[model samples]
Target: MLGSMAIRALSLSPLDSIAVVVHPDDPLDWLPALGNSAFSASPSAWPSIQVVTCTEASQGMSFSIRCGLKALIDDNPKLDAVVVVLADQPFITTGMIAELIGYLSERPELDYVATATDVGGEGEQNAILMPPAILSRSMFEVLLQLEGDAGARKLFGLPQFRGAALLAADRTTVFDVDTPADMVLATKQILGQTYIREHRF
Candidate 1:
């Protein structure tokens, strides 16, 4: 039901740019379209759209995020804003992303704009955005030094990092593909049929 609802829900606007970071063997899927629609087409606008790859992504989630951010900044030093999106978040629609971009577009001074989802299992909603603040190359490096398993949460509570723009979205938005069970759910949702049922399980 969550997947169906996500497919129907109206979206906001396209982000200025989206960072689609994934592992080496990850599927391309709709990611290339996201890049083409948002970044590749408009040269004068946010022309620097990119799909970043984390060579060390095999290490863990932290490495993937750190690598992606570094790649973005390394390629475009003048980037004022960015949105970090995972490769498998099929529910993350263009409208939701646009909402975040529109908010940041209005208030450029805001450090970070994250999509907040109520993953009830966590007791509190989780924030999905990276750097979690507007940081310079040096600050990002320092944050990278702090990296462990948990990733961006380490820098979010820091002093210099201003704060995050918590834009509320559906809880199902954060449903990530972490395992085979997750894969089943994704397949069922995308195809509108249960994989288990199809396989006679």
Candidate 2:
């Protein structure tokens, strides 16, 4: 349900399709909002989401990404492009999703694109976006063979794949639900502070 809500709040357009890759063992607390977002999104142009859950999801993020990418390519061999998103990022509103899709739609020449917020640091800020371009099926196969916790860093470095990082106006776009504290915060945002106290703890 948490992921569904994430989908509903996304800025979806007629031009793009989204592939939501979730871990089979995703926390129960995150379900309601995600499900709500996905089901509540504008039905007319609602993205075709392929829920790819793998047993190896317990392995790492890369496994999940590879599973999702493989599913997307296998199901829709002609998939033009896909927005690789995280189900746990509750703050990413639908408007942000639309903006990213819109930017990519206007410029098809770019292999892939991502949105990031500046996390103030010493010299420069850290940029985070969905990794590894999902341009071709061959690229996805290569991703499936990848190992460890790395998402798609090496794949993006290849000459054939090009990417762009959009500076997010709202930094909340970069907040990802990765730990117990993150779950508590996300639950409050989705189900409200009062609800958390009354139900989720």
Off by over 4 Å in 2: 10-45, 121-141, 157-160, 191-201
Query: What lDDT score goes with residue 112 in model 1?
Result: 53
Residue 61 in model 2: lDDT: 73
Q: lDDT for model 2, on a 0 to 1 scale?
A: 0.61
Worst 10 residues of 2 by lDDT: 129-138
- Put down candidate 1 lDDT per residue, 1-201, tens digits, no spaces: 332222222122344344556577866564444334323234354434456766667776678777767777777777665555555555666566666667766765655556555444452355344322233333566545645465665555677765554544554555666688988887777675445446874
Worst 10 residues of 1 by lDDT: 3-12
So what's the TM-score on candidate 2?
0.70
Cα RMSDs, all models: 7.5, 5.4
The whole-model lDDT of each prediction reads 0.53, 0.61
Q: What is the lDDT of residue 140 in candidate 1?
A: 63
lDDT agreement of model 1 with the native: 0.53
